[model samples]
Target: MFKKIVMFLYVMNLAFVGNAFAAGQDREDGLPGMPYRTPTDKEFRVCADPENLPYSNQKGEGFENKIAEVLAKDLGKELTYEFWLDRQGYLRNTINAQRCDVIIGMGSDVDTLRTSKPYYRSGYVFVYRKSSNYNIKDWNSEDLRKGIIGIVGESPPTIPLRDNDLMANARPYRLQRDLNLPPGHMIDDLVAGKIDVAIIWGPLGGYYAKKAKEPLVVVPLPEFKSERNSFDTLKGKAEFNISLAVRKKDKDRMEMIQGALDRNQSKILKILDDYGIPHVPVVLSDKIGN
Candidate 1:
């Protein structure tokens, strides 16, 4: 469900091509020979996905869209977007390619971009019908073994699911799909009783659960340390801090964004609450690495 989230952090890093600029430049926009164009004072150019929701879409209805509006308003600039699909080559085609000045939301640990201070933190969650009365809060629950589970293939939760021997009864959904397609199908199946439970990213699960006709339960998984010598793909970290991103050379733009985020923090949080997004406190001491 959060293929966009995972791909943005891990896959996009491969698109970066190392660049060097001369030292002691007087410009705040770009140094003498920088590749990308700096953002102008008149417009806040944003790189965004046109169809992913709970995050972004063309209609400007997602929480990221709302947050972008807040930032742009605070910065005294008109908001504009370079719409792209959040898939492989996304960074190569958009921000890194110089199509936009900022990405409204990205994982804070992504090495390919200069990310701002995190605005919010979120993680994967368990979604099931409230009628089922399943009080599952962790991966060790016996109920998970008995029920048919739905999960996005290759996501962080899969590591624990496999370790618990629950893969035999689990159904996997595609992580990457066509650009025009939107998410929330797994939660749709859960509400229709096609699956007993859905283990998905928190924002996706929470938004869909709030929209479901039948009441659904959303439980956040507790943080756990990855075992030493473990070969799990995600290293057992389910939560992550999300931040705005700029080109590696755009430190000025990053600092400007950070100021806007600090000034409008409450408005941004209100937008997340209005969208039914589930979030956790961003604890710097417990920060996860790339």
Candidate 2:
């Protein structure tokens, strides 16, 4: 049922992003600079997760928040957030529905919205307690079958789990586990020995592993033979090249963001590195047509 809901949300997100036009001139949806002329609004309103650290938080500490500040300064706007948890209809409820104007980190593959050129690319990773001496890197590892693995439920990482029949013994992290709690709570579980291993999204896993109270092993998943890279393959529905998304009809807004992003690419990457995100170099030519 969770999977079905997520799939539905994915489809709806694409629809909302691709169309790009304002819903209705008669309907006011809680934002400015749409359905009319150039936006002179002084605020650069963003939609983000309040507790999803390493990505975003209300205090403006996440890498995305730093990047947003950079962009705001570049564009001469003030940064503001519409905080939402990463839950069902996140895209539909916030930016897509026009309750907010922008999202800093979204995959570029969604054809629904006009996404900025990807700023960076990353993949999933395997995180385990170093004290356990577990060094499994691939799903094909025999040790994986014997271990009590942790995975965020209904996420791309679960695909390899299902393919290998590892769900029965898995310690599944509910997608909406703790709204008030910080994101990537699984790493703490690993530290406490509540779980033997965790397959986590790269940014969260890499960041938390470095921040763990005790040493934890973090390994980027190897590319499956059938797939090109572990990150791209498992998250097959999308690429890891994260970008800012805007309503499609808002081409002017999109261009403004794209330019700002390009101008500050170096600073943005440094922020990501500080968060310990494992990613590939961005090919600007590919993200933006040369």
Candidate 3:
């Protein structure tokens, strides 16, 4: 009888071991059978520009660069950067090609690109001289009848700009010193009085408005929607969210990347705020693109 009892116990132990192994296998082979493992001892890749300021650079001084650092720390991995000029083709050639795993500081609304939830949002604003009596209450206020507004060629402005019939009057001009230009430079011309007003991205608008040493007010554009910003991966890449991209495929490394982002979202935001990263949206509106 004692031997029989011992045999029963041994059988139970074997059963438990089999179940454990099955569960582990299931986790490793998630539904659709893609292996999802938490990565460790890996370097996660981020795409960045070598010279772009306020965004990213090799020195890792840009806002996105700092955010990457925080994310890497949270993931328990090292941060690796791939330098690409901030151009239309950068994402495809670098990020999509697996040269980098993520594109930080991307517009969250770009439907063609996949994005994580927005950590910050801001509206397009026109920066103008403080001395000007531009009572531009929002994007589509009637007060704009008094002045000419500058905008970048083929850039997105809030609804009022799109509907207000000002595109005909607002002239497109080149403002950035670099070939990879940002729309905010129109505001630079506005401060210099090259143009009366400039529709600009919130961060750059906020940054240069202060730097010009000119009196400027960042008036919120009504009907002007806040552009949600986030990091990007390839569209429909289901595992892209949690996986780390290496030049070669390594399942364990991917797990580490996912763990890092999950663990560090809050800390990343705080670091961004400390540097005046300018991501948090002060307002929320339900209006869709007009």
Per-prediction TM-score to the true structure, in the order listed? 0.84, 0.76, 0.63
Report how far off residue 188 is in candidate 1 (Å). 0.6
Candidate 2 at residue 76, lDDT?
A: 98
Evaluate residue 191 in candidate 1 and report its C-alpha lDDT on the 0 to 100 scale.
87
How would you encode candidate 3's per-residue C-alpha lDDT over 134-198 as one tens digit per residue? 77775456657567777643333523464566666676653223445543466667876888887
| Cα lDDT of model 2 by residue, 47-71, tens digit | 8877677878899988889999999
Error of 2 at 224 (Å): 2.8
Question: What does candidate 1's lDDT look like per residue over 64-114, in tens digits?
Answer: 899999999999999999887666556655676676888887667666567
Q: Which residue segments of model 1 deviate by more than 4 Å?
A: 1-3, 7-39, 178-181, 225-234, 286-290
Off by over 4 Å in 3: 1-41, 109-114, 139-142, 174-184, 224-263, 271-290
Query: In model 3, which range of ten residues has the least summed lDDT?
Result: 1-10
Task: Give candidate 1's whole-model lDDT.
Answer: 0.73
For model 2, what is the C-alpha lDDT against the true structure? 0.67
